[model samples]
Target: MDGKKALYYAAIAIAVLIGVGIVISVISALVTLVSTVISAAISLAVLAGIVYVAYKAGSWLLGSDDSPSMDSIGSGSSTSVDAGTSRQDRLRQQYVEGQISEAEFERRIGEELETEEIDDIDRELERER
Candidate 1:
Protein backbone atom coordinates (compact mmCIF):
# COMPACT_ATOMS: atom_id res chain seq x y z
CA MET A 1 0.00 0.00 0.00
CA ASP A 2 1.00 3.66 -0.30
CA GLY A 3 2.47 5.73 2.51
CA LYS A 4 -0.70 7.72 3.16
CA LYS A 5 -2.90 4.63 3.43
CA ALA A 6 -0.43 2.84 5.69
CA LEU A 7 -0.17 5.79 8.05
CA TYR A 8 -3.93 6.20 8.08
CA TYR A 9 -4.41 2.56 9.05
CA ALA A 10 -1.73 2.80 11.72
CA ALA A 11 -3.42 5.84 13.19
CA ILE A 12 -6.77 4.08 13.18
CA ALA A 13 -5.26 1.08 14.96
CA ILE A 14 -3.73 3.32 17.62
CA ALA A 15 -7.05 5.01 18.14
CA VAL A 16 -8.87 1.69 18.47
CA LEU A 17 -6.33 0.39 20.99
CA ILE A 18 -6.59 3.49 23.10
CA GLY A 19 -10.35 3.34 23.02
CA VAL A 20 -10.30 -0.32 24.15
CA GLY A 21 -7.87 0.44 26.98
CA ILE A 22 -10.06 3.25 28.23
CA VAL A 23 -13.17 1.09 28.09
CA ILE A 24 -11.45 -1.80 29.89
CA SER A 25 -10.05 0.45 32.64
CA VAL A 26 -13.50 1.98 33.20
CA ILE A 27 -15.19 -1.45 33.32
CA SER A 28 -12.51 -2.88 35.63
CA ALA A 29 -13.34 -0.33 38.30
CA LEU A 30 -16.99 -1.46 38.24
CA VAL A 31 -16.75 -5.13 37.19
CA THR A 32 -14.53 -8.17 37.98
CA LEU A 33 -10.72 -8.07 37.54
CA VAL A 34 -10.35 -11.22 35.34
CA SER A 35 -12.37 -10.02 32.32
CA THR A 36 -10.68 -6.63 32.24
CA VAL A 37 -7.19 -8.18 32.20
CA ILE A 38 -8.15 -10.56 29.36
CA SER A 39 -9.61 -7.80 27.20
CA ALA A 40 -6.47 -5.64 27.67
CA ALA A 41 -4.19 -8.55 26.74
CA ILE A 42 -6.15 -9.29 23.54
CA SER A 43 -6.14 -5.63 22.55
CA LEU A 44 -2.36 -5.44 23.03
CA ALA A 45 -1.70 -8.48 20.86
CA VAL A 46 -3.92 -7.21 18.06
CA LEU A 47 -2.31 -3.77 18.18
CA ALA A 48 1.19 -5.27 17.98
CA GLY A 49 0.28 -7.39 14.93
CA ILE A 50 -1.23 -4.40 13.17
CA VAL A 51 1.87 -2.30 13.82
CA TYR A 52 4.19 -5.02 12.48
CA VAL A 53 2.20 -5.46 9.27
CA ALA A 54 1.93 -1.70 8.75
CA TYR A 55 5.70 -1.29 9.19
CA LYS A 56 6.38 -4.00 6.59
CA ALA A 57 3.96 -2.46 4.09
CA GLY A 58 5.53 0.96 4.67
CA SER A 59 9.01 -0.44 4.02
CA TRP A 60 7.82 -1.97 0.74
CA LEU A 61 6.23 1.34 -0.29
CA LEU A 62 9.56 3.09 0.41
CA GLY A 63 11.45 0.87 -2.11
CA SER A 64 13.86 -0.72 0.34
CA ASP A 65 14.61 -3.82 -1.78
CA ASP A 66 18.13 -4.96 -0.87
CA SER A 67 18.75 -6.53 -4.32
CA PRO A 68 17.96 -5.03 -7.73
CA SER A 69 16.90 -6.90 -10.88
CA MET A 70 18.26 -6.47 -14.43
CA ASP A 71 15.04 -4.86 -15.71
CA SER A 72 15.26 -2.20 -13.01
CA ILE A 73 18.94 -1.41 -13.76
CA GLY A 74 19.01 -1.34 -17.58
CA SER A 75 17.10 0.32 -20.43
CA GLY A 76 15.65 -1.18 -23.59
CA SER A 77 13.39 -0.31 -26.55
CA SER A 78 10.08 -1.55 -28.00
CA THR A 79 10.68 -1.31 -31.76
CA SER A 80 10.54 -4.65 -33.56
CA VAL A 81 13.08 -5.64 -36.22
CA ASP A 82 11.75 -5.32 -39.78
CA ALA A 83 11.44 -8.64 -41.64
CA GLY A 84 11.35 -7.17 -45.19
CA THR A 85 14.87 -5.75 -45.24
CA SER A 86 17.87 -7.79 -46.32
CA ARG A 87 21.24 -6.84 -44.77
CA GLN A 88 22.15 -5.24 -48.13
CA ASP A 89 18.89 -3.25 -48.14
CA ARG A 90 19.63 -1.76 -44.71
CA LEU A 91 23.12 -0.76 -45.86
CA ARG A 92 21.66 0.89 -48.98
CA GLN A 93 19.20 2.87 -46.86
CA GLN A 94 21.95 3.93 -44.46
CA TYR A 95 23.91 5.36 -47.42
CA VAL A 96 20.85 7.01 -49.05
CA GLU A 97 19.99 8.74 -45.76
CA GLY A 98 23.50 10.33 -45.61
CA GLN A 99 24.04 8.75 -42.18
CA ILE A 100 27.31 7.17 -43.35
CA SER A 101 29.78 7.81 -46.18
CA GLU A 102 29.88 5.29 -49.05
CA ALA A 103 33.39 4.19 -48.07
CA GLU A 104 32.45 3.59 -44.40
CA PHE A 105 29.27 1.79 -45.44
CA GLU A 106 31.14 -0.52 -47.76
CA ARG A 107 33.74 -1.21 -45.07
CA ARG A 108 31.13 -2.08 -42.44
CA ILE A 109 29.10 -4.13 -44.97
CA GLY A 110 32.22 -6.12 -45.89
CA GLU A 111 33.06 -6.72 -42.23
CA GLU A 112 29.59 -8.18 -41.61
CA LEU A 113 29.69 -10.28 -44.83
CA GLU A 114 31.43 -13.25 -43.19
CA THR A 115 29.81 -13.90 -39.80
CA GLU A 116 30.12 -17.40 -38.25
CA GLU A 117 27.36 -19.28 -36.47
CA ILE A 118 27.10 -18.18 -32.84
CA ASP A 119 27.48 -20.82 -30.14
CA ASP A 120 26.66 -20.54 -26.44
CA ILE A 121 29.58 -18.47 -25.12
CA ASP A 122 28.43 -19.04 -21.55
CA ARG A 123 28.39 -22.82 -22.03
CA GLU A 124 31.87 -22.77 -23.58
CA LEU A 125 33.23 -20.86 -20.56
CA GLU A 126 31.58 -23.31 -18.19
CA ARG A 127 33.18 -26.25 -20.08
CA GLU A 128 36.63 -24.69 -19.68
CA ARG A 129 36.01 -24.29 -15.98
Candidate 2:
Protein backbone atom coordinates (compact mmCIF):
# COMPACT_ATOMS: atom_id res chain seq x y z
CA MET A 1 0.00 0.00 0.00
CA ASP A 2 2.77 2.41 0.87
CA GLY A 3 4.63 1.44 -2.27
CA LYS A 4 1.53 2.03 -4.41
CA LYS A 5 0.92 5.41 -2.79
CA ALA A 6 4.53 6.40 -3.38
CA LEU A 7 4.33 5.30 -6.99
CA TYR A 8 1.07 7.19 -7.55
CA TYR A 9 2.42 10.39 -5.96
CA ALA A 10 5.57 10.07 -8.08
CA ALA A 11 3.50 9.74 -11.25
CA ILE A 12 1.41 12.81 -10.38
CA ALA A 13 4.53 14.81 -9.61
CA ILE A 14 6.10 13.84 -12.92
CA ALA A 15 2.95 14.77 -14.87
CA VAL A 16 2.69 18.14 -13.10
CA LEU A 17 6.33 18.87 -13.81
CA ILE A 18 5.89 18.15 -17.49
CA GLY A 19 2.77 20.31 -17.62
CA VAL A 20 4.54 23.16 -15.84
CA GLY A 21 7.49 22.92 -18.18
CA ILE A 22 5.17 23.29 -21.16
CA VAL A 23 3.47 26.32 -19.61
CA ILE A 24 6.83 27.91 -18.78
CA SER A 25 8.14 27.39 -22.31
CA VAL A 26 5.02 28.92 -23.78
CA ILE A 27 5.22 32.01 -21.55
CA SER A 28 8.89 32.47 -22.46
CA ALA A 29 7.97 32.53 -26.20
CA LEU A 30 9.85 29.29 -26.84
CA VAL A 31 6.55 27.99 -28.24
CA THR A 32 3.05 29.29 -29.00
CA LEU A 33 0.67 29.17 -26.03
CA VAL A 34 -1.95 27.01 -27.81
CA SER A 35 0.59 24.54 -29.14
CA THR A 36 2.47 24.41 -25.82
CA VAL A 37 -0.70 23.81 -23.84
CA ILE A 38 -1.74 21.09 -26.26
CA SER A 39 1.64 19.45 -26.00
CA ALA A 40 1.50 19.63 -22.20
CA ALA A 41 -1.97 18.10 -22.18
CA ILE A 42 -0.74 15.31 -24.43
CA SER A 43 2.30 14.70 -22.30
CA LEU A 44 0.22 14.62 -19.12
CA ALA A 45 -2.28 12.31 -20.80
CA VAL A 46 0.48 9.96 -21.86
CA LEU A 47 1.87 9.96 -18.32
CA ALA A 48 -1.60 9.24 -16.96
CA GLY A 49 -1.85 6.28 -19.31
CA ILE A 50 1.53 5.02 -18.15
CA VAL A 51 0.47 5.33 -14.48
CA TYR A 52 -2.74 3.39 -15.10
CA VAL A 53 -0.89 0.69 -16.97
CA ALA A 54 1.72 0.39 -14.28
CA TYR A 55 -0.92 0.17 -11.55
CA LYS A 56 -2.86 -2.50 -13.43
CA ALA A 57 0.29 -4.47 -14.10
CA GLY A 58 1.40 -4.20 -10.48
CA SER A 59 -1.97 -5.21 -9.07
CA TRP A 60 -2.33 -8.12 -11.49
CA LEU A 61 1.14 -9.37 -10.74
CA LEU A 62 1.08 -8.59 -7.01
CA GLY A 63 -2.58 -9.11 -6.00
CA SER A 64 -4.72 -6.39 -4.35
CA ASP A 65 -3.08 -3.00 -3.92
CA ASP A 66 -3.42 -3.05 -0.13
CA SER A 67 -2.07 -6.57 0.11
CA PRO A 68 0.46 -6.78 -2.65
CA SER A 69 2.47 -9.99 -2.43
CA MET A 70 6.21 -9.64 -2.01
CA ASP A 71 8.24 -10.07 -5.19
CA SER A 72 10.30 -12.86 -3.65
CA ILE A 73 7.24 -15.04 -3.16
CA GLY A 74 5.74 -14.03 -6.54
CA SER A 75 2.39 -15.09 -4.96
CA GLY A 76 0.81 -16.03 -1.59
CA SER A 77 1.36 -14.64 1.92
CA SER A 78 4.73 -14.34 3.57
CA THR A 79 5.21 -15.49 7.13
CA SER A 80 7.61 -13.77 9.49
CA VAL A 81 8.59 -16.12 12.31
CA ASP A 82 10.72 -13.53 14.16
CA ALA A 83 12.96 -14.46 11.24
CA GLY A 84 12.17 -18.20 11.73
CA THR A 85 12.19 -19.10 15.43
CA SER A 86 9.53 -21.41 16.83
CA ARG A 87 6.93 -19.83 19.10
CA GLN A 88 7.04 -22.75 21.52
CA ASP A 89 10.80 -22.54 21.77
CA ARG A 90 10.70 -18.81 22.30
CA LEU A 91 8.15 -19.18 25.06
CA ARG A 92 10.19 -21.87 26.73
CA GLN A 93 13.30 -19.71 26.50
CA GLN A 94 11.48 -16.80 28.11
CA TYR A 95 10.53 -19.05 30.98
CA VAL A 96 14.03 -20.50 31.26
CA GLU A 97 15.58 -17.06 31.21
CA GLY A 98 13.23 -15.91 33.97
CA GLN A 99 11.71 -13.27 31.70
CA ILE A 100 8.30 -14.66 32.60
CA SER A 101 6.92 -16.84 35.38
CA GLU A 102 5.35 -20.21 34.54
CA ALA A 103 1.82 -18.91 35.13
CA GLU A 104 2.46 -15.80 33.07
CA PHE A 105 4.01 -17.83 30.26
CA GLU A 106 1.08 -20.23 30.20
CA ARG A 107 -1.41 -17.35 30.22
CA ARG A 108 0.38 -15.53 27.41
CA ILE A 109 0.77 -18.67 25.29
CA GLY A 110 -2.91 -19.46 25.61
CA GLU A 111 -3.85 -15.89 24.71
CA GLU A 112 -1.53 -15.86 21.71
CA LEU A 113 -3.13 -19.07 20.40
CA GLU A 114 -6.65 -17.73 21.11
CA THR A 115 -7.47 -20.51 23.53
CA GLU A 116 -10.75 -19.89 25.32
CA GLU A 117 -11.17 -19.96 29.06
CA ILE A 118 -14.40 -21.70 30.08
CA ASP A 119 -16.15 -19.86 32.87
CA ASP A 120 -17.17 -21.79 36.00
CA ILE A 121 -20.86 -21.53 35.01
CA ASP A 122 -20.12 -22.99 31.55
CA ARG A 123 -18.18 -25.88 33.07
CA GLU A 124 -21.05 -26.61 35.46
CA LEU A 125 -23.57 -26.65 32.60
CA GLU A 126 -21.42 -29.10 30.63
CA ARG A 127 -21.12 -31.36 33.66
CA GLU A 128 -24.92 -31.32 34.26
CA ARG A 129 -25.57 -32.29 30.64
| Candidate 2 TM-score, true structure as reference | 0.28
Over all chains combined, what TM-score does candidate 1 have? Answer: 0.29
Backbone clashes in candidate 1 total 0
Best by TM-score: 1
Model 1 agreement with the true structure over 1-129: per-residue lDDT tens digits: 699999999999999999999999888776766778889999999999999889877877797744443444542221111211255578888899999999988897775553311223444575799
Where does the lowest 10-residue lDDT sum fall in candidate 1? 75-84
Candidate 2: residue pairs that collide: none
lDDT of 2 by residue, 32-120 (tens): 76788999999999999999999988987777765434553542112332222357678889999999999998987786554223443
Q: Count backbone clashes in candidate 2.
A: 0
Model 2 spans with C-alpha error above 4 angstroms: 1-31, 65-129
